[model samples]
Target: MRRSAEPDPSGEQAPHWWQRAVFYQVYVRSFADSDGDGVGDLEGIRSRLGYLELLGVDALWLTPFFRSPMADHGYDVADPRAVDPLFGDLAAFDRLVTDAHAHGIKVTIDVVPNHTSDQHAWFQEALAAAPGSRERARYLFRDGDQPPNNWVSVFGGPAWTRVPDGQWYLHLFTPQQPDLNWDNSEVRADLVETLRFWLDRGVDGFRIDVAHGMAKPAGLPDMPEYLRSVTGAQAHGVDDPRFDNDEVHEVHRLIRKVADEYPDTMAVGEIWVQTDTQFAKYVRQDELHLGFNFALVDADFDADAVRRAIDLSLEAVSRSAAPPTWTLSNHDVVRHVTRYGGSELGARRARAMALVQLALPGVVYLYNGEELGLPNVELPDWALQDPLWERSGHTDRGRDGARVPLPWEGTEPPFAFSEGTNTWLPIPPEWAGLTVERQLEDPDSMLSLYRQALELRKTHAGFSGTDIEWYGAPPGCFAYRRKGGGLICALNTSGAPVPLPPGEILLSSGPIPTTDLPPETAVWLI
Candidate 1:
């Protein structure tokens, strides 16, 4: 693919690197551990820059490592500017950025603007102050007898938590993550300063957490009955007071203003709005540069479902002329390998889907450990750490399974992730054949396929386009050709093999000894 360039400050064309860049999401605590404390840290990530550069990703998004109480891992941040001692100090973060940039890689960190750790000074002060005091005004605190309106937490239970003073505060996720009042000028200004602090320190950009949140509707009305359940709310849309509020756009516009000051820096939102029009609002010209359209992530492995997701995502981003982004897995969801089918069959589908995702235009985000074909590990009840486990009374199991530490090397439990024979979450003994050391020696390995696909996506003229043209295919299969670049990507999700398109095969998820695309296989052709 040709490099994407945009106009710079002096009217000179410069590489708008992020437009077609591949971003790898690094869940910090599970990536690597240099201190052998059973937790991954900055120095460990800095030590792995060569691996990332060789893997061929243009940038990496690190999950929150800011100072926190670890209530929701690092999401419950106590200090937005300070790095937690658990992940190393701010100086360690600087070293990681410097070394990463030296290796020609960009660094983007997570910004949790919708809420702050309950232990954060602001939240703590809000707790200490009177009901309507200035300190309490920065957060949503309601003094009522019936606990405001009925709204449930995304995790579980009521969204409002009562203070000892008989007033209630809003917490969309956990009580530990208090929702911030964006209506307060102080809250907006503080977020701006946080953005500048990291940009000045040489970071590339940010992944805004809960980008559709931070604003609440007037009256805090009760959510409609049909959207009361967690699954129902996610399926229907974000029409509740808890999320996707109209005022959220103003917050994103504020963020875009700060990002514009730094050239080539972009802000991608984790928007969960349902409709194409609603999702487009977050990426408007004056808002975020990109929004994470999770259609592909949420879609089933069926060919028709996959095609629909791609089509909807393209249409949504086209409204604002914003670049579209795609992903198969992230820290918060089940790994795609397991989500597909959870065994050898799942691995095959995942490999095929990787080509499908990388073949599309625009930016792509690859989750850490995804290249190794990592599947979600079924952990014992005693080993689960996600707050949802406790918050849901152990019924939901939470996301801890997907967040297991990466298996870098070795044959046993820790898999060389930590010098100690332990990890924050156990690495199953079955991953012996999937370690990076083992896979690097095998050309047919998942890691090798990813490395090759990413390199091809970067240099192949066949991948240079912003739009795709649909090609008719057999039932249970789909094909699309890149406009302006005659690259063809085809996939077979049917029960049997299908005829291959007439073209020079560039790459395939599985070997094609015959002139046919086998079930659960995808190929890139030119």
Candidate 2:
């Protein structure tokens, strides 16, 4: 059957498929378990398509589901061509692509090109080959008594691990996940082949993981002094020549080539860069479709800070020839409901933040459970599965807290995730009361507010328009105007009531205090 073409609403064809899209990020292990084996699978995600459609997302960004040993979750791919048995096989994946498209929602899978699990056949072959052999050169292998460079792993240890055969392999993450040598033409070719394998399956696009780390400095020099403080002997910043090396562009070019071969296929990069200008480089005409903006994710919630991020993002996209994308929370970070605050006031602040995200001029990513106002689960160190926990001596407490299983049913035994006896991550007790079933029935629940916001976004041109004008607000307040076609929108993020300049209030959070905003309240004016 011929594939259906993507709809281009505006006359100027959309620069990238993801721009203007509302993406729901699914942490596969915790989404749903079809086999009742205590783990979420592709079929499980298929069952939730209706729920996603109801929430009004255009696409879904699923975390890695490839064959893996699970050391660093699915990021440590042992085989890029096949799905892990634990998650489901290739046939199941094809079914998911078919099901999601039928619902008008695109599907993008996570692709970890920076590294591979030690168990991967490529790595295993390199390990067995003689030093300096063609196969061994595909990976960074050094025969010296020490590592080739002073780079450190982000997981808090030396980035190079010595093989028993007197050679060292580089790893930007855990020792089990060795970094790939992008300088090798064979490695790049294989990666392209792997990508094409999926694209041919009707998958819409890919979310490239740790994309900036694909290249290492050619010189492989010792760690620089400026990076010492931040590195603490760990991985350097993405811009570090040894990290986001210029050679990384070649990787993108290859990905772009593959994406262009198929109609409507897109590629988004998870680039950890400081400035939007630097981030812009990742989305040029020949690079990725969207380079996610981490500025807001790391920004302090304040009028000035928020305004700066938005302005910077706009300026960056203007410089780039491609569209932009934005996200708040993901599986790797603290939940927004907890990061902002855990009280009723905190929930209100989170709502305001959501308004800004949805109103931004690019694609927006929504992490799972955000609609239910879920907070990070406070799990004990013993239950943590993230390698960060083991490497940091439990001080960092890894990402397990934010990755708890979803609460579909309110009951304790299954937690609505599965009828199985074991779940990948235990559901937090507090989340049971905030289950999907319970929230769906409560009109004042966060779920309902999210549904309404999305509904408004679809109907209100101001919500999805790219044209924006920043409006100055009093201390501790944020205001912005979005105008498109004939629609206008004004938003106030302030604690005290601020007089509206005469417009209808389309939506509001919390009560307005004395004609001003109460703490953690936001209002949309038309």
Candidate 3:
């Protein structure tokens, strides 16, 4: 296959580098450990830049490293300008950015604009006695005995929690992560200031958390009771007034304004909506540069589901004239390998999924350790740290199973994280054999396949472009073709033998055994 034309990067005609780039998502608490502490820090990430570069990622997305109480694993921000001491200070973060850029890798940090820690000074002052105080207006407060309305929290409980002195405040996650009042102009301006602070510091961009939830319905109405179940619950509902509130556009516009001030700076949003149309709205030219498509994350591994999702996503992006972005897994969800394919066939399926995602037209996001084909580790109730585990009564293990620290060294003593006295989450027993060191030396390992796949993507013309055609196929068989740049790419997502029309094979999950697959086999043909 011919190589794709080099990306245009000359003058005003240059395309954004992120448009054709691959991004690596780093969950800080689980990525690497620098100090003897059990937690992964900026220095730990700094030490792994070369490993990422070797694995073929263009940039890195670090989940929030800001000063927080760790209520939601750093999503509850207390200070946006400073880094949390547990993850190292501002100086350490600056060093990470500097070293990352030196290694040709751009860095984007998670920015939680929708809320702040209850311990934040702004929230503290809001709770204090004051009439029409600026700090009080920073967050929503209800005067009556009841809440401002009856909206439920996304984390399975009442959205409103009462503060001391008898006033109700909104909290979308835990009471610790108090929702900020976007209705307040002061709050919006403050958020813009926070964006500017990070941008001016040499940070590349941001991954806007809960970008859609930043704005709430004016009169928070009662969400349906059926949506409140702890397990098997539809965390988000169409009937819920919180669905794509119009006020959210204003927040995006403000964020866009901030991005415009910096050259080549990008902002990607975590908009967890049902439809592709709703997701597209967040990526308008004047809004966020990219918004994650959650359809793939929630989709079953069947062919029809994957085809429909790709079709809908393509249509949405084409309609909005915006670039698309795909995320298979993140800190909030089950690991892709475990969720899509069972433990027995998980690794094989994961490789095929990577080719599919990488071949799609847009920015590709890779979660840490995904290249190693890491499976979910079962943690006992006593060792789990996610609040969701406790909140949901252990019905769901929350995300701890997937958020364990990355195994860089052999799974022994510090598990390659830190030589510290205690690790935050216990390293799983199997991690010893799946360490990065072991994978690097093995020729047929998932890590090696990932490197080759990314190199192929960077050099293949068939992998680039926005035009795509979803081909009809059998059950459990997903196929798609991208036609442009003088190349045609097709993929099969089934365990059965798929007859390839007259094209050469570009990539396949594993050796073809008897022209039949066990399960979760993927093939790419040109």
Q: Rate the local accuracy (lDDT) of all candidates.
A: 0.91, 0.79, 0.79
Preferred candidate (lDDT higher): 1 or 2: 1
> Residue 128's C-alpha lDDT in candidate 2?
83
lDDT of 2 by residue, 1-526 (tens): 2245677777666555566788899999988999989989998999989998888888999998899999988989999998999989988998899999999999999999988899999888888888898878887877788788776667666778998888888887899998888888888988888888888888889999988877887668887656643422123564465566778988998999888888778899888775665677788889998887776776666777777777777777787766556777888888888887776656777887887777666788899888878888888666889988777655567788788878887667467688787787777666767788888888878888788888887777656566777665677776677755323333455555666545667776555545555556667777
lDDT of 1 by residue, 1-526 (tens): 1123355688876447888899999999999999999999999898888899989999999999999999999999999999999999988999999999999999999999999999999998988899899899999999888779888788877889999999999988899999899999999999999999999898899999988888899888888876656532134355666788889999999999988888778899988887898998898899998899999999999999999999999999887858889999999899999999989999999999999999999999999999999999999999999988888877889899999999988788688788887889998999999999999999999999999999999999999989999999999999999996899999999999999998999999999989999999999999
What's the TM-score of each model vs. the native?
A: 0.97, 0.94, 0.94
Residue pairs with backbone atoms closer than 3 Å in model 1 (clashes): 1-460
Q: By TM-score, is 1 or 3 better?
A: 1
Error of 1 at 124 (Å): 1.4
Query: For each candidate, C-alpha RMSD in Å?
Result: 2.8, 2.4, 3.9
- Regions of model 1 farther than 4 Å from truth: 1-15, 231-236
How well does candidate 1 score on lDDT at residue 466? 93
Model 3 / residue 462 / CA error / Å:
2.9
lDDT of 1: 0.91
In angstroms, give how far residue 80 of model 2 lies from its true place. Answer: 0.5
What is the Å distance of residue 18 in model 2 from its true position? 2.3
